[model samples]
Target: MNEVANPGSSAVVLIGTAEYDHADVERVPSVSANLDDLYDALLDPGIWGVPAENITVLRDERDPASVYDAIRAAARSTRDDGLFLVYYAGHGFPYDDDLVLGLREVDPQFPDEKGLRYPKIRQATQLAIALRRVVILDCCFAGRAGREVLDAGDAVKQIAGRAEISAEETYLLVAVGPNELAKAPLNDRHTAFTSALLHVLTTGSETADPVLSIRTVAEKVIRRVVAAGHRRPEFRAANAAVDAPLVRNARLRPHDLTGVVLEATADVTDPELRGAVILVLRHNDSGALGVRLNRDFGPLPAALDGWRDHVSLPDRLFDGGPVAQDGFISLVRLREHEERPIRFTEVTGLLGSLPLSDAQQSARDRIADLRIFRGYLGWRPGALERLVTHGRLRITDTNPFHAAFARAPFTRTGS
Candidate 1:
């Protein structure tokens, strides 16, 4: 049985730099431009389902030196409470049995000679020695980076001999096998391995094992990659005798509440809802309460969809649950200092409720123009708290920009 684990206990490092000065390997236009996308995806509050303070992201454009230092810090730190994830996306080159991750200026001809250097697998294993590490390498030849360090006899002996290990443990999940090449599909705009990995982790396709173990996530990623037209990715387990849980053990139990009503049953209709923050709504016979947020809703439009007649709200309504597919409701928050005459019920200081107007034509227009949802998330008062206590549900605090508006709804051209 999979055990529930706390997400707050971990730290994540995202390093991506594609501006290689010397190389025929077409500098992945998407890698450099989509650095923020990769960063945002990892740092997404919804992904962690935990508080912002618990997660930290180090990217190339923001701080280059700190990226390496952060990895070293994680390696040295002794925190057995949370999991640690390190994601690297860019060019990867194999050196004999070992692999080297290229930084921004890595020259294909001279990997070690040029640009910043870090032992992709060795450094990750060093960090895993102390914490539960889920190292995701999205670059080519990533599989070879950690092979040597993990296979070291001394390291294996030290971990294997231990009699008792905690449920919270460390592991690694690489994108491809050491011998195989990792390729991103042109249509998906993401590496085949990565796309499959994300799908299994978030799509709830593997819901039977909600707290995914290293073995399980690895198997799913490998299968998905191969099925998607790529070579089989590899799965390596270190210190298996330790019996550490791969994914944190947790469960997000369903909540039963009479407050709000949802409009949709399936998540397919709203592609935006996938891997996004949303507001769920539930309707009672008399009225309804729109769950302020079902997931982590991203950015809001700078201006309302159609603000000519009345100053519109800044948020877009999204499908929150699998219930009503056509019903629409919204929770609008006034600007920090700006006050309006509209009457509303306060869900929280930062969130308020506004009912759909009675006018049929106006209501239809509002629903069509704005991003409205059919259903919402319904949580009985204590149910959410219970899930949090059991490590099932995580409430994330995110900035409006980072949550929704920062990146384009669609991937940038090259990405």
Candidate 2:
């Protein structure tokens, strides 16, 4: 399950330098817009709803010490379970192998001395008591922060072992790789990466979970950035923090049961579907596809006898639905720590569908769970939504594994 950071206790610091003093470094007028749009996105009720009081915005800051002070205060103020977020959009001055944040007074000739060094930002974040921390960089060579901050196993740097800055709770979203430059078109309203991020936050993603995880947002942002022929962005998060909820999804509502469990309502008169437990394999604007979990379709077909022994509990072909009864759909859960295998379309988490032929003999040891279903339920684009809205099907939070393996029984219940 994805945990939502407590908005009231969380803190956000957004710093943007739209104007610079150095003659060599160009000013980014769009940076001011970036801060505004992100501030609005963070406060959107449908998104995170973080209180305005908890957020601080600094534009064209003249003093690097003030920036450090803001980060320090926010980090110290956030509670243990809250999230601490810091965002910087401006000129990134490369100092040796480290990246520095350019302020209004930054001197390109002496970047390390005039700019806010990465180590200062690291030290402030390391002092935070918050359980989860996020740092977003939208400047040239932003990815260098990843090498400096996220490589927790760095032997030379003993500070990387700090608890607050550990890999388990820290996440980095950089606009470009260490060698690439972030795009800031003069006429554009925001930098390329920030524009993509704001768009995803406001519009939300149809394929993501009900709550928007940072990882999901990063995936969409990276795709958009790459599609526009801009520098590719990078995302780094370790452990469960990868799936932590950054905000409520603006697109997928609770009634949209894509990759979710659905049980028939008790009052349903359809004998074939009543008391049915189903796992929706796919739901989109086109339609929905689901497989019945509890209904028994007798033993495995003779042609698929080879899979009978490898299937999970309740090893039998299931009466998936009325559509294409001759066809088969196989769901497999890959073992923990295993990378997604080829020829698999992930449904949710580690659960995914595998072609019968592909799973016949390969990577058998990596299979943690498996289920085979005959046929599947189908609904036109709006049909399933109407059914859900009218209470014919009850959306459930049941773990997908239970439905995949038929580990639990669904009773004829209320909507």
Best by TM-score: 2
Candidate 1 residue runs with Cα over 4 Å from true position: 1-4, 32-47, 58-65, 74-78, 115-121, 124-130, 148-170, 242-415
The sequence of per-residue lDDT tens digits that candidate 1 reaches over residues 1-415 is 4452344555556666555666465555445434455444433322334334544454343333555666767554435655666767777777655666766656677676543344633454366434566677777766775553353235467666778644434455666667666675554555566667666554434365445566666777778787877877665545544434444222332333222222222332334323334332332333333332334233443434544244343454444455454565544444554453245444444344456553333333322122334455444434333333344333344543233223234331111
The parts of candidate 2 lying over 4 Å away from their true place are 148-168, 238-242, 253-415
TM-score of candidate 2 relative to the true fold: 0.57
* C-alpha TM-scores of all predictions: 0.55, 0.57
Clashes of each: 34, 0
lDDT of each: 0.49, 0.78
Give the best candidate by lDDT: 2
